[model samples]
Target chain A: MIIMVAIDPSYLITQVLNGLVWGLVLALIAMGLALIYGLLDIVNFAHGAFYAFGAYVAWQTLLSGGNYWVALLTVPLAMILLGLFVESTLLRRLYGQDTKFTLIFNFGLMLVIVQTCRFIWGARGKPISIPSELAFSVNLGILSYPAYRLFVIALTSAIAIAVFVFLRKTHVGMATRAGIQNREMVQVLGVNIGRIYTLIYTIGICIAGIAGLVASPLFGVYPEMGAEVLIPAFVVVVVGGMGSFHGSILAGILVGQVATLPIIWEPRIAQVMIYIFMAIVLLARPAGLFGELGR
Target chain B: MLEVRDIHTFYGDSHILFGVSLEIKEQEVVALLGRNGVGKTTTLRSIMGLTPPKKGTVLMNGEDITHEPIHRRAKIGIGYVPEDRGIFPGLTVHENLTIAADGVGAPGGNYEDAFKFFPELGKYLPSRAGRLSGGEQQMLAVARALVGTKHVLILDEPTQGLAPKVVDRITHAIKGISKKTSILMVEQNTDLALRLADRVYIMRDGNIVFSGVPQQVRDNEEVQSYLVIS
Candidate 1:
């Protein structure tokens, strides 16, 4: 008797696509965290809270009969305003004093925001409907995929390109990038370092907001959902290295694959795979994959 | 156009400058000369508001600005080129030149002027500052200061470690720049100080030991006493 074991190509393709999409989202979060840490020297533990807030904002917009495109614009704007207010009133005071104060303050902020979200949204997770036009799947020669997932990939790719161009081509972006290496040098040249700090923080928060708003439909909007992504995103940041942009992107993809691919064979060990990878990488290269020592 | 009067700067409990006073006229080049760690750089730092003096005043063009921030001091026409040159090692030469030209009223918008001052920097405009040679870095530091609106340019040890030819190149550029903008330089090389400065002050143990023209300082026997290795 001959026994045949079948391998499903569609399953593999779906897993790979899922990994890529999730990796891009994680990259967005990690990049924002890294940018804030690099320029303002703040670890921004409240970053995930900002992401959750963005999702809530999107939910509110959608509830008011706004389309996905409208929520897309409104979420980032709302987050930017909140970021500016928080930065000027609270975070600004902690700067130049102690990093520990900032870290604790951000942790407090995360708690406060998560609690506020819980009080408003209640214990039940809210389901967000995908846009009517994007509800269908597109046939790609081998497998059919959701149009919205492709849209997410395209949108993130565009944002990544824009960010790369901004950092490489513009004067302000170049100064910001240079400031990460040496702040005093930028200051002596007469650039007000404080103003740059505000801009960097706001931009970082806005990016987090974007990630949250987009992911709300896929992952039901819930209060503690931020923590679910936050833990793994921190892992991505550690694997990418502090203050390293390209490092975070590569590490995010690696992590997404490690987190998702194992589920096909054995679902139990999927979560543990990322930590094992991180530990091995840290042991081999303490500075992270592309991170510089003593940053 | 600058006056630093009775400045007493301190670094924590250890006092660095004791009643140090100096003056720089419009378009004049004043050099502060001393051996290592005699508070020459401290005086510059105090004036630039990096390590502000506890008891003293710094006046630029008649406005007292002792408590001003470092960037504010730069905005008010005080361009400080520090000892280490303060180059943004990751940025290109062109980016370094343009990063701080946000305000108006200083003579920093002329690319031809910067290129005319140091032609060697032209080739390195696209290269990162960390790759440049010592002389080129010094030229870039001075060039960055001049690119913005700055009336009083403060330089600390511009030729500390360089080939004699590079020193000549930097000194020649300073002389050219000094004709247009007032300069306050700190130099360990007494000959270079005397050659470029209209007036010279010798610092010793956190105080101005002697102040006179280069010839008077060269002739004074007391100057030798201050120069002795501690």
Candidate 2:
């Protein structure tokens, strides 16, 4: 059965809005990935699993009659704790070792976490009802859209701005940024490089966690949902320069547009469009759009 | 005061320093001179705990600190200005100095004094360090290490690649800084080393072949043969 696609103004506006929200969500995940890679020099294959884990934590909190706002705050914090545990238990050992060691270790971690979530939450998808305050539609002169979608976009933008300020204005943030450039130099300057590594890893995954928590109501919570976003996040990181914060956000939005814009003309082709776009961009820039050579 | 006694260091099983030992007294400027690949840098690395010595004692103010990590050594008042200068090119000059100011060392120090030492750094505070001239970058590196009130400053090839005028400027800065804290330096420019160093130790093949006052080192033929004259 053919599902008819419409190209009306309202439809186009709605798609663009949806794409923006999804792009920002992807940006959130990719930013963490980029930060981790930049500082810790780890690809963090288990990031998506951590994302799913956060959603599950949010689901658990909400299911226990906790407020939506509380779950939103608590979920990322829970993810940070989980991140700390994961770092100290596993990733810490892999630091300063061969890159392949972390790659294989995190790959194994992804499987373990995915399987653990399946065992706990079951294989079926779980739905989280949108908060009542955000259930209404928002009208913006030219378009009417779900208020929740607007909230997601606003929240992500705020987070991005906050991160920018933290990295630029604060002393700890400066040390972290310095560590990204030269870990040994930072260490010799009396900055605890080991602690910085743990903090960055935790912060990275917590951002992923927040992305999962926010996306759960829209996308549904499922064990394999993380697997879906994880691959796209990889694409986003590649399309963006590895370790560039600006590059990840731009690439995420670009991927988001490429993924959805084509759906108006041909629904079937939209799925592969992102990959094709990535390939084309990579062919032109090689290291990615903003990727530094040899980074 | 700082002391490294019979320290042995390795780079992945290839021993780079064998039983290397040295001493710096209070407010003394000591220079380590050697030909290329003779473990001058390795000695600094061992003292900094960047490459922990396999066997030996490192003493800071008469306390054993051989097992301390790099940051701990810094916290205990050892400031290292590395061979490459170790400037974060992506960060601005102000950011570079700010990071070191945020670091732990002698208390009650800030970026103002650093800028004062290298007045040229004030103009480039907003510019990325990578864009700075080599002399400007070296100034920034040294200024970064000196941002805090450190007890001991270890400089590895502080004037490795700089113009004569810039080298003279750095030499003047070192003279000013040496009055505040003890310095252990590794220099290729023997003339500059002799000028700044109260005493000199010459290393040959990871071992100290000569240790004497600057005038004594200037008079010795054996140590002169191992030195890199500039």
Candidate 3:
């Protein structure tokens, strides 16, 4: 028996746009992971949990009669405060310890965060309606695309650019890059590297929080929502280069296409294809596309 | 300006410095000379609090800083150029100097003073530090220290792997810097150390074996016995 299916060109365009949107969201999460890893040398397995927490918080805000704009404005600030607390209380003690210690700690922390969400919000997924401003679709030459997804792409791109400028142009940002390269030297040069560490960790967490809040309207808020994206986001980071900021952006978009394009063919194999692509890339370049060897 | 009094330091339980002591007065250039593995680098690390001494005090301008963190020690006017020069290879030369200056709240015009010592660095401001030649990197390291240092600068083997011509340039820069800030340096090149230092301390087995003026070091038999050079 032969199966014949007709594929629409507009559907392909829609899938590509969807891929871009998802990729940008992944880039935000991956950048946070990269920043924390670059400076602190921690993999931060709890990053996904932080994402879930942000979504839940946004959901809570909206349910409490606050608007989507309010959630967007306040969620990152809340994440920053939470990040400060977590870094000082838990991660600080593991600074000089082995990397595996942080891995295990973050893994456990992820479990705690997920369970906390379950206790407070229950186990069902919470839906967030699209904001009225972005509720409509924009007509492209080939297809009509969701305005919210396009907005996500634009906002994320702007954020990525801002982060790049901050790292390259500002004093604290220069120190952060230097610290990522050589933490000891930055300290010896009279920078309070500890403060840089706290700041970086908090900023990273805040970014993850923003990504979570932004994604919630589409993906819905749930205890396990973060875990669903965590692996793919990690793949983005690894493929981009562990600590390279620009690399994450490129890899995120690539992985997003790899994730979404395959759905047009076989949806069941889409997730497996990501890992296979990662394996091939790792085989070709052990350091990933942009990472320095032995970094 | 700086005093290390009988400090004991270890590297994860393997003791590297045992009761080592040294002093640097205002605007004086003091060199610590010793054979390899005799704890010269360890002495510098101890003073910088990279490896905080377990038993003694590190005093800066009469204030004890034995337990102060590395950055705090640097903030209190301790500029350290480690054995490997400690240049952030990924950063640009301009960025390297800027970070050092900002760390200590040095004036914006400090870059010009640093450029005065090594004018070649001015041309390489936008280049990555790792791309610089060894001599340029050493110059950048010293220049970086000069930009932020208020009271004293600490150097560990600044000319370890440089060419002779480069060594002469560094020596000239050191002489120029000495007029501005106190320096505590470790050197294997006894002749160069003696030429640039106002005072010299010789170490053997993590302890100060001999210390005196350059003339006394040349004339003394005991100091010669400790050092490889006669």
What is the DockQ for all candidates, taken in turn? 0.55, 0.71, 0.75
Q: Considering the two chains of model 1, state its CAPRI-style docking category.
A: medium
Clashing pairs in 2: none
Q: lDDT (0-100) at residue A69 of candidate 2?
A: 88
Using DockQ as the yardstick, the better of models 1 and 2 is 2
The iRMS of model 3 comes to: 0.9
What's the distance in Å from true for residue B85, model 3?
1.5
Deviation of model 1 at B156, angstroms? 1.8
| Best candidate (score: DockQ) | 3
Q: How much of the true A–B contact set does each candidate keep?
A: 0.69, 0.80, 0.82
lDDT of 3 by residue, A1-295 (tens): 1221367889988998899989999999999999999999999899999999999889889988998999988798789999999999999999988789999999999999999999999999999988999999999987898899898899889888989998988888999999988888888888888898999899889888899998998989999988988899999999988998888999999998998988988999987988998999899988887888877
**Candidate 2 overall lDDT versus native:** 0.88
What does the lDDT read for residue B105 in candidate 2? 44
Second chain alone, TM-score for each candidate: 0.94, 0.94, 0.95
Off by over 4 Å in 1: A1-7, B8-15, B103-110, B220-222
lDDT agreement with native, every candidate: 0.85, 0.88, 0.89
Q: Return the lDDT, model 2, position B65.
A: 94
- Tell me the spans in candidate 3 whose CA falls farther than 4 Å from its real position: A1-7, B107-109, B219-222
Docking verdict class for candidate 3: medium
